[model samples]
Target: MKGVVVGGVSSGVGKTVATLATIRALDEAGYAVQPAKAGPDFIDPSHHEAIAGRPSRTLDLWLEGSEGMARNYARGEGDICVVEGVMGLYDGDGSSTAMVAEALDLPVVLVVDAKAGMESVAATAYGFREYAETIGREVDVAGVIAQRAHGGRHEQGIRDALPDDLDYFGRIPPSSDLEIPDRHLGLEMGAEAALPHEALSAAADHLDTERLVDVAREPPQVDPEPAGARTDATVAVASDAAFCFRYPATIGRLHERSTVQTFSPVAGDPVPECDGVYLPGGYPELHAEALASADTLTELGERAGEGLPVFGECGGLMAMSQSLSTTEGERYAMAGILPADVEMCDRYQALNHVDLEATSETLTARAGESIRGHEFHYSKASVDADARFAFETVRGDGIDGDHDGLLEHESLGTYAHVHAASGAFDRFVDRLR
Candidate 1:
């Protein structure tokens, strides 16, 4: 599909707003838009899906590799795709936005925060474009989207400052209505704090729709992998507001090997009849009382005690713990499947790319195997000192100083969220059989 990567100079540069406005501009131009994210950012893609009306593809080179990223891009359905970058253009290690642009051979549309200066924004975009070549990353910083710039002289001055090499795509006017709220983890989810439709449309009116589409070349072609035939085994996955941080690809992988069943613990839905359980991450802390009052955790505790394999990530790890306390120090009970107490805090405990090596055979990985994922959490767990951990840190901050993967009975829980391409879910699926 034809696409362009919307990158920023750094964090808080309004990449999400620019991307959404770009999507709206493309839609205004009568293009069926498919949105995607450059890194392992599950939250931004939620906004993309909200605007695009389809699940956005996740393209991370570190987690999915070049071939896997291409495959994921190829799976996206639409005439064009708008892939939003993470952090700055070349900020991340292997999973940077520049890497994805180079891997897919797509041009980069840098989002510049132009709320302050005019020529300075152009100069900053010029430096970012040139810096990519010095780093040996073949990324094309094709254009600039002036974020928070007013129409008349403001947008004109920014446009006049750009050189021949760089094109001025458009600007997102500074307005409070376009702002998305934030919490400890990141911006409040897209569905919760979405910008008004008129705001997006007005932003669209400011952007250069033709130039934006012109820079978007078709990504490198890769065939979509065929889905495996469904198996008789049922894999129960948690959904609803609490357990909602799952990647679409992860669920697709599970369905390839088994029947997928979904239930909401926050809604008091009991754990479904299944051979395996998958609890993805979301805002369990905000709904701790409802989750604790549900029969779902009790049933999950019982199933784990009966030797059922249960896997959890982030919020899932919190809900599976012995107890969970909110930021106000109000405590609520959890599944009590693992011997740990989770407590929410004002700041994130872990926020970075994570590499964990399995020290022992676990539900999702063999002993000594490595998994590449990411962890961003506001809660810390107080585990029993004698509790067994299946993984040791290779890169990021884990549950403890250098370890993660709290394992008990047949259940395994960790803060890191892995993609199916990492083979973590593959192992989980294999364990079910």
Candidate 2:
């Protein structure tokens, strides 16, 4: 599992293009390539999956922890793994990409938008490298790939500005066709609108493959075992477009221990015969009306009433509410299990690094146990005082003042999005078993 990280100076810096291009290049070169996105983004992973022919997993230090990251890296069986960074290198709440790099001990390839002069570009790279070092991660600046360089002089300017020790990868010329379409959530994931294979091949042609391969080093190896020899725990994973922020590593972990089944809330799908349900995060507000009228909501509410163990995060939490009102004020009845009303807000409520102290035994979370994760959503819910669960204290930006996980019977719902590597998933499975 050799790894390479593609980071940018800031948002819109072409990390996605670089990541996809690198994955395609490696795959074309006959290397078993695996892709990993840095943050809790669902759309980017979809694109990664389209290119890699496998699901792209997320590695968030805040949510998955150091051990989780190591386990995921070790488990990912690939000749070369590419991990794409979010926003910028040091742009996470408390655990940034630099932190993740340090946790996994992987080298980084900095992608700078060279629309500006050379000296400024060099300064930007210098700042990122210094920041990575300041955080105690001695990240090897494998090389710099310039995007949108003006003429050939932009590369020279960057070369003149950078230190003699830094390596220079190639540059990607500006192209209107290479731009990926975006929507309110992020990039459009429909098959028709996906990035063309030719575009990815062109980007790969521009990148210095030899340099990237040189910097890429394999992760520590772990023994692989035969499947289906594990316990009989069933994990119910949400699988609709509205709530699809799941990581392949999470699913793999569940499958390693027990049988994993998927159910959708959009088709009015019934909850399969399972001991526990794992509802991931996604854009639930977009389909609030359909989810409100779906039979799955009613069935989930009934299960919650029966004390079935259910855990939901982010948009899943919004769907499990009593009712949902969209940003346009379109109201729809929801599960009515939590006695809470969710209203989609015009402002996006994105928060990173949520630390919680569990106050109850729901989902096997012991009282006084603390867990770390992140939250990104646009809907706000108002819970009745009598219906709110007093399980955990949340310390994050989106959480108003102090917040706790909502509990109804054995169900726990909240806006905090957790990684599958977090012990929470395993604990929930074990409790159900």
Candidate 3:
């Protein structure tokens, strides 16, 4: 599908608003808009999916290689894809928006905060466009979207000042309604707090929808392969506000080989009867009290001890631990599946692309095989000395500097969040089979 990257000058520069507006504008122009996010952020993509009416493809070169990222993009069912970029246009090492654009060979429309100046916005856009050439990056900053600018003369001044090479896509007008609230993990889930449709429609009215469609180009051909090898294992997944950081593609992959069941451990649900259980990452810290009283935790601990294969990532890692002690000094009992004490932190412990080389055979991967994923959390897990480890960290922070993937019985707990494209899910289902 044809795609375009909605890049920003930096974080909090209105990239999400501009991208949402662009999606609304394109959809209004009779195109099926598929949204994609440039980094390993599950939050921004929530807003994208809320606006676009579909799951936003998570494209990160570090977690998923160029081909893997392309394949994820190829799975989208739409005429065009609008990728909401990460921090800045040229921020990350390998997972930057520019790198994703280069990988997909897609054009970019820079989102500049036009709240302050007019002509200066045009200059900033020009710098982002030419800075790519100076840094030897294969990026095409085709146009500019003036964000937080007022209508009438303010918008006209910004448009009139733009260089002939850069197209004036449109401006997201200044309004309090356009802003999305945030928490420790970033913006609240779009389902909880999405911008109203009328505000998005207003921003779309000013954009050049024809030009957006004109600038988009098709991505390179990707390998059409499913996430994991097929198996008929029943995989019970933890769901609800507490354990909600799962990808649509990841669930889709599990459905390809397993009967997927979802139960909320935070809502006092019991663990379902299944051969395997997949616990995703989310805000378990916020719902610790409820989770402490859940039957699922005790049931899961027992089942995991009995050799039922279990895979937990991030918040899941915390949930399967001995206990969770919050920063406010409140202590809650967890599943006790892994020999570790998880504690909430004042700041993020790990926030980047992660690489883990399996040290031994684990529930999710075999020995010697590497898994690529991302970890972003504000909690620390202190493992018991007798606890066995399954993976040695190659990149980013794990439980410690060197090791991740704490192992006990048939279950594995790690801070790394891997997608279906990483082949971890395949290994997971294969192990269950």
Residue pairs in candidate 2 whose N, alpha carbon or C atoms collide under 3 angstroms: 1-219, 2-217, 2-218, 359-391
For 362-422, candidate 1 gives per-residue lDDT tens digits of 9999999999899889889999989999899998988996999999999999999999889
Residue range 317-386, candidate 2, lDDT tens digits? 8877888888687888877777688887777766567788777676736777777777777777787877
What is the clash count of model 3?
A: 0
Local error of candidate 1 at residue 277 (angstroms): 0.9
Estimate the overall C-alpha local distance difference test score of candidate 3.
0.90
TM-score of 2: 0.91
Off by over 4 Å in 3: 226-229
The candidate with the higher lDDT, 1 or 2, is 1
Q: What are the runs in model 1 whose C-alpha is more than 4 Å off? A: 223-229
Cα-based lDDT for every prediction: 0.90, 0.76, 0.90
Model 3: lDDT of residue 346: 88
Q: By lDDT, who's the top model here? A: 3
Instruction: Give, for candidate 3, the lowest lDDT window spanning 10 residues.
Output: 222-231
Residue 154 in candidate 1 has what lDDT? Answer: 84
lDDT per residue (tens digit) for residues 330-398 in model 3:
999999999999999888888888889999998778899999898999999888989899999999789
| Model 2 residue 29 distance off true place after TM-score fit, in angstroms | 2.5
lDDT of 3 at 86: 93
lDDT of 2: 0.76
| TM-scores of all predicted structures | 0.97, 0.91, 0.98
